[model samples]
Target: MAPTKKKAEKKGKIQEFCRKYLTVDFVKSLIFSPDKLSFLTYFILFAELALNILIVVKVKYTEIDWIAYMQECEGFLNGTLDYSQLKGDTGPLVYPSFFLYIYSLLYFVTSRGSNVKLAQYIFIAIYLLQLWLVLRLYSKTRKIPPYVIILSVFTSYRVHSIYSLRLFNDPVAILFFYIALNLFMDRKWTVGSIMFSLAVGIKMNILLFAPAILMLYITSLGYINTIIQLSICAAVQLIIGAPFLMTYPVEYIKGSFDLGRIFEHKWTVNYRFLDREMFENRMFHLGLLVLHIILIIIVAKPCYLFFKNYARLRTLQAQFEPQIAAENREIEDLVRKKMRKATKKADEEEITPEQKKFMDSFEKGMKNQFGDKQQMPQTKEEEDPQKIEIHFDQCVQLALLPIFLINFIGVVCSRSLHYQFYIWYFHSLPYLSWFTEYHTSFKILILFSIEFCWNQYPSTNFSSILLHACHLILLFGIIRKIYKEIGLARQVIKKEN
Candidate 1:
């Protein structure tokens, strides 16, 4: 009896300790609470920056294309805009005039092209700016949570490599991309378009984002405004290209916009399974073209449908405002009464299965009909003025979907994928996570797979395919889920009417 009592006492103490320190609320308070989480965010950022600095100091020289960048910068400084004679491992200075002009400014600070420290410092500043812009964009939109910011800051090894080792123009391009996204979210459409144009100028790969941006502009602003904004964007690109066009028009055209340039099989990191001869086959290129066409259609169709349905829903809601409001009030009252009863029952004892079922049904109906009440515009005047209303999270999800799909498809059809290409998808991953409903272990597995593929010295064809395939599955799943939710919403609205 004495031994059993002691054993019981020990078990009770363990349970008490767990209740005090290991409860979900306790863990959530430690990590998910905004104030405590902000500290974690800062610590992660500081640690990443410090580690990157240390790596830069230790390596002292990068093995990638920094030398080529410096050569282009030197050529620009020497007033030799023609890059026909200047070639790098990736071929030539294939970037636009604005990139050359921007790189040339480094001449003012560093005399030697081999000054890796100076280059790293410049890139560190760019990285810090990118981080700040990301945080500001998320905070302003109120779309992503604090945990996402932490994930972005910590899981960005590819970005760190770009800044510290590769020293590519990608970071600069991404800086502009983030700034443009921020501006677009803030409704500074014209300036955002110009910034996006500049991003495309720095690296043509940034054009992957153009379709989505165009759709967003057209939907947010009317046709005339969108056209004007696009014209301004085109004007910015032309202005940046003008000097190069005049000096060496043929070379500028070939270098800046030549989409047909084929990389060698030896240089191909992602398509090794095709082997040397098969990598250069015309049939493969044709297949890629077909794949690109299919992907474009797939990505665009849903965007169009979503926009159309969203517009129709808004119009219908506005037309039946009185009826919708009455229904909403009735439902809200019913939900409150049910909630009160549930709370009273909970105070007395555990909720019955029937009560739980009713609560679940009530919540689902409420969500399908009106979304979260907090997300609905409070003022009737404000609600009526807007043609369409979308929750901030939904808005972000829609805006990023096209870009994510395009980048994924680009990777699928790409003949060559390098570690540096990870930039194309890295920024979108955290946002994509918001739409996914994977278990914690599954999410961790996905993260591990991505990191593993990226860390490979020369990415194997299988790993490349796997990484891209994983993203495709996730994106398609989210897209399907979104449309299904929209369908449910429509049904609920129709029923209410």
Candidate 2:
């Protein structure tokens, strides 16, 4: 039996536990667990498929953003639309022509023009591609099994079908962004940079990764290489964007940057911490800016340290210190041997190889928890001497930092947010999964509980505001912790290097 057997006792199945105190800890563990994919299919795929069917039936069966998208698409297709002439009083036309390009293709297929279901299908295809890329990246880096990928894909309520079904810029931009990240991780800089540029072009919010990416580029490739990559990315953008640049450069930039001008409403769904009324006060904006800057700076310091530490560690590893390295290897081998023994005893009745591997890994991890630290690296000599170098590769992942920073700033400065904007919350999930070593189950539960409260309770002004405040606090905590981890990792890398 797995260690989780005790937790599973008296339960019909894992999903049934949803009724049992939200078991946030357990849920998160399952989601992030190594054995998660051992039997992933019966859970993740079915659940997501079922949920998507329900969503499609409920919303897709009827017309959705079809009317609005059609208006946008028709204007683009007729060539009568200058895009320059098209302006919204609320904001600039920030959405890239890529989406419109997609719509144009769909419009051509049936000649029925822009159909909502068709659009939904198109977005779903894009999402599937994103899912594939995300899984591939996860597998390459973490060695997680494919079934685990399925579980991760579906179990994350925030990232599932709902976002794809919506006709928002988030879905497409996220797809491009993840692909960009994956390409960057693979060290295909030109492709990754172009993808990132396209993501930013599609939706400017993707620019949040700018600082981290730049830092990574500077560290890894040096200033000259970073410039070359940037130039390549810029050239790609110019190729696609030149025509529009010629006609409406100001409109494009304005639409991309001036998001605040659109929201006249005082509050939407995310009304916690502050609101539009507060921003109108001017003093509020100043105060918020100061707070955000302080937090970002605090977070950045740790990330820098983490980079240094990682670099140092890598440098040390390259030295092949036989005595120390061999001892460390022996300890790891012993742990694995013990874990296998334990797994054999526990899984005597029946077991899958994948499950057994996971159990073994889990047990080894547990044993290592109590292992002697002194045996690993007690002296400065054991550490890598080189300074950690941050590269564009790291920047691709680091790009997530800007997302958190910008969003934190936005949460503090913006007047209000809508339920729809919860998509932004989903953006943090990958960061949490890939970046941190914190207790997964615990974090998942906290956020899930908040999400439940936000979703389930009937809206009362007081409850709404209270929930918003709590959510903001949670967001703040998550961001702070993430930055801290990044900093710590940087330090570790630096030491190792």
The number of clashing residue pairs in each candidate reads: 0, 39
Runs with alpha carbons beyond 4 Å of true place in candidate 1: 1-30, 33-44, 86-90, 140-152, 305-394
TM-score of each: 0.73, 0.63
Q: Residue 30: error of model 2 in Å?
A: 7.5
Maximum-TM-score candidate:
1
Residue 176: error of model 1 in Å?
A: 0.9
For candidate 1, what is the lDDT? 0.69
Best by lDDT: 1
Give residue 306's error in model 2 in angstroms. 3.4
